[model samples]
Target: MYTLLSGLYKYMFQKDEYCILILGLDNAGKTTFLEQSKTRFHKNYKGMSLSKITTTVGLNIGTVDVGKARLMFWDLGGQEELQSLWDKYYAECHGVIYVIDSTDEERLSESKRAFEKMVTSEALDGVPILVLANKQDVETCLSIPDIKTAFSDCTSKIGRRDCLTQACSALTG
Candidate 1:
């Protein structure tokens, strides 16, 4: 199974349809960012399973083209209930986008815990983690450096540096 999956992955990577999973707490704007991506627009994507501020219920698969490659964007459910489901799919993912709400002060701790869980989880070892410092347009948003620090601290716990965390402004104009 691993061989077949690996071959398929190589084909996709060459053909450029590698899959990526996007994760963040509720209200992190993960969906909004996917909805507004240029590839989404070009694909004329008709979104499935849109949730404004609730647990994802399950995974939602979306497609976007990134120049040479087609990106399979997997938007994971961010609610606490859905966390258990994350480990099952983490191994299949090629990359990740870890989104965080910049303005939610009370939930930062929760976000940190969730991130820490991913950092320590066995399923995500050596995966490329892209941290999206979302909601940057808000008056009170976490800075890129702060996000990187949090990610770095979590990764340090594992005594490995496989988590490549990157911060991006998903909502900034």
Candidate 2:
């Protein structure tokens, strides 16, 4: 059974569609990240204006094909009121990209709480998580290591799940 399941997983990953959720607190750069990703992955893609990107009231969906993998991304709104809608997409997401506004020290605690809540969900078990410490281009932005330390508990809660935390500038990408 284990071998069969492993084979099925490999086959699906190699030939089927995959979904990724881009989640974070409001103004944490989720939409910017999605736009950047689209610009980078899609050929001749005319990306959105970073300066004009506004808060996401609901969700922004994007798709890109890289090699044989057709990736569908759900960039969900991160407002406190919209967080309830996040879990609805979790069960179908193959991976998660959790963004954080590295320059907003004031909301670090709130972000941490939200991250902890997401990572603890049973639906996300064994899913790979990429925590992007965004807004690094800001002069006052926290360093990647500092951001990681701030969410140490959240990462620890992702037990046995593959997770990577990195600093990035969504605006510059």
Candidate 3:
């Protein structure tokens, strides 16, 4: 009887875990987004002060419980060299959040290239992608339409998967 009751208790409390990857070019606000999410979703979680956040040299991990689901976020570093390591986590991720620094027009093409490569990987086939045009609060940031236009070519490579593009100021939201 005790064994059966313990099993029931475990089943009742276990959560469905989903692993999400937060990826983008350096300074694209991936970490900020993660911090904000944790603060919002997990009551009593005192996240780091956003102003003092620094470049993620490797990765940062955070978890939030929503309903019966637990979301695990892996915020990866976006440096050119670090990008090569992104694929190592692809197979395990349930979804990908690709952040683009809309205010940095000069690096837009480079960001697109990286994004194209990520979506084409067979490991990420059919994985849902959330494209965030970050830094929208900046005066000169690109609009969602502009970002969509710039990344139009990648649509074909994205395959038949759930994809969305939205403007977000990670720092402010």
Candidate 4:
């Protein structure tokens, strides 16, 4: 009875290993989004009241399962020092999810640079990228067309496919 209950509980919630890579520039809500998406709200965290999360480390893996698919969320290291390691797992991923803090105008250049690096890399050359123009709920979030244009142009710079990027709250299943 205990084993069955535990299994049911995990499945009912979110946990899995589909290997989804979340890439973006630093402080792009990459970590906080992962935290909130996986678990519920907590009162102890500093930004819990303001609705934000602290910085993330070099690398982290967050899991969320939908249906029978296990989503192994890979939160890559956003720092200049750690980004060199991104190639190690890029090939291992089935898909890519690029998160952009549309509200952060200052980081746009970094975002473009990072994205160019991704599409030009050997590992992610053909993998379909899902860009989350996140923080759209915010007043300054970039328009979907603008974000898509940025992404499309980056892919063009890297000579990769310019598939229409979609605005996703979360990629389910």
Instruction: List candidate 3 stretches off by more than 4 Å.
Output: none
Report the poorest 10 consecutive residues by lDDT, candidate 4: 41-50
lDDT tens digits by residue: candidate 2, 25-68: 99999998999999999889999988999999999999989888
- Error (Å) of candidate 4 at residue 101 is 1.1
Q: Provide backbone clash counts, one per model.
A: 1, 0, 0, 4
Find the candidate with the highest TM-score and give its number. 3
Which segments of candidate 4 are over 4 A away from where they belong? Answer: 1-16, 40-52, 157-164, 168-173
Q: Kindly state the number of residue pairs that clash in model 1.
A: 1
Report residue 3 deviation for candidate 2 (angstroms).
31
Stronger candidate by lDDT (1 vs 2):
2
Position 116, candidate 3: lDDT: 95
Cα error, residue 135 of model 3, in Å, equals 0.8
The global C-alpha lDDT for each of the candidates, from Candidate 1 onward, is 0.74, 0.92, 0.95, 0.71
Candidate no. 4 TM-score = 0.73
Residue 61, model 3: lDDT of 100
List the candidate numbers ranked by lDDT, top first: 3, 2, 1, 4
**Model 4 residue pairs with clashes:** 15-65, 16-70, 17-70, 18-70
Off by over 4 Å in 2: 1-15
